[model samples]
Target: MNISPTDFASLLCSRLCHDLLSPVGALNNGLELLADENDPAMRARCLELLADSAKASANKLKFFRLAFGAAGGFGDMVDTREARTAIGGLFGDGHRVELGWMVEEETLPKGAVKVLLNLALIAGDALVRGGRLDIGAETIDGHVEIVVRGEGPRIVLDDELRGALGGTAGDTITPRAAAAHLARALVTENGGSLQISPPDAPALMFGAVFNAA
Candidate 1:
């Protein structure tokens, strides 16, 4: 519960690395195959696979930069469009998941953006069967409210992640739950609350409210 800044940073880095490993590894493998393959058609296919892997790696890095790192330069506010693009690129490539962006504001506080992106990451991951992801954010009465919903034939949200999102994970936080923990910590630090739907619920949803001040 009381993780030092350094420890939290390490956890976040671990999570990013874990998420990137698959795509990055694929890129490496694809490159190796491309170099050794001699058949013309097969070589072209290897090139296509390399391109796909490279694109996936790039997309994940972009998403993680905004979700886990300082990506919007020195500004206190971040463009909502960037967030939407990052989310869309991360999940829209294969067309396996549908993205719905409902944020009307052109920009949002950097902290709120981070919370929204991390919550979106969790919700997107919950859609194990590749479902629809809806993300919305708004500022009203000096408070920023964020919501993320994932709906599909089957949604699975791990108990640890749910607990982390609700700020009830205590000292059992792991790299897999780093994003959820980050979202909870950001909301709490901003004098707000984070909520998560029950695991057995038909759909998985995340809600967070933070003081805009």
Candidate 2:
């Protein structure tokens, strides 16, 4: 789809705001409650709620910094450890999803890292009922190959996301599908290919391959 850079950026910003609204709003509400509740136990509960919201907000920001912004300094390659931490922080709370990191490479090209993280984001979100998320990547034959898999009792990969990943979402792209669109665009720009498992399959899988930096 022909989208101006500014428009694409606006879409991403909208997505970020939507995802963060809940936790940030909770923080605001928690603060207000803490101020009103004079009871020690209630005030303590408020503090706990505030803490959880703060952590969630921080985790999302960290993940977005790498997945959607210029994180990992001004380098062409980023450490895989940082990526692992970001993903862990995003899903580690309450064990909503289990994460398996299988990337053997110490570092990867920035474009490859962004694509990998975004694919993981999509796959993780597909597990609406909580599930296992496995992310793996490696460089072979001068190409970096990345794969994200999600398995659970129920998986929901919406049509909009599928269309975005396939570059067939057409003219109207919702904020929710922005990550998929960004991943597809990056892979195409790198002369790479993206593959999504059949929607009816038992599990959901996303794979992408691009030249190594």
Best-fitting candidate, measured by lDDT?
2
lDDT of 2 by residue, 96-142 (tens): 89999999999899999999999999999999999999999999998
Model 2 CA lDDT for position 150: 97
The lDDT values for all models are: 0.88, 0.93
lDDT for each residue of candidate 1 in 1-213, tens digit (9 for 90 to 100): 788898899999999899889989998998889889899999999989888888888999999999989886754899999999999988897848999999999999999999999998888887888999999999999999999999998788888988888767878688999998888888998999988887678888888898986
Q: Quick one: best TM-score, which candidate?
A: 2
Count clashing pairs, candidate 1. Answer: 0
Backbone clashes in each candidate structure, one number apiece?
0, 0
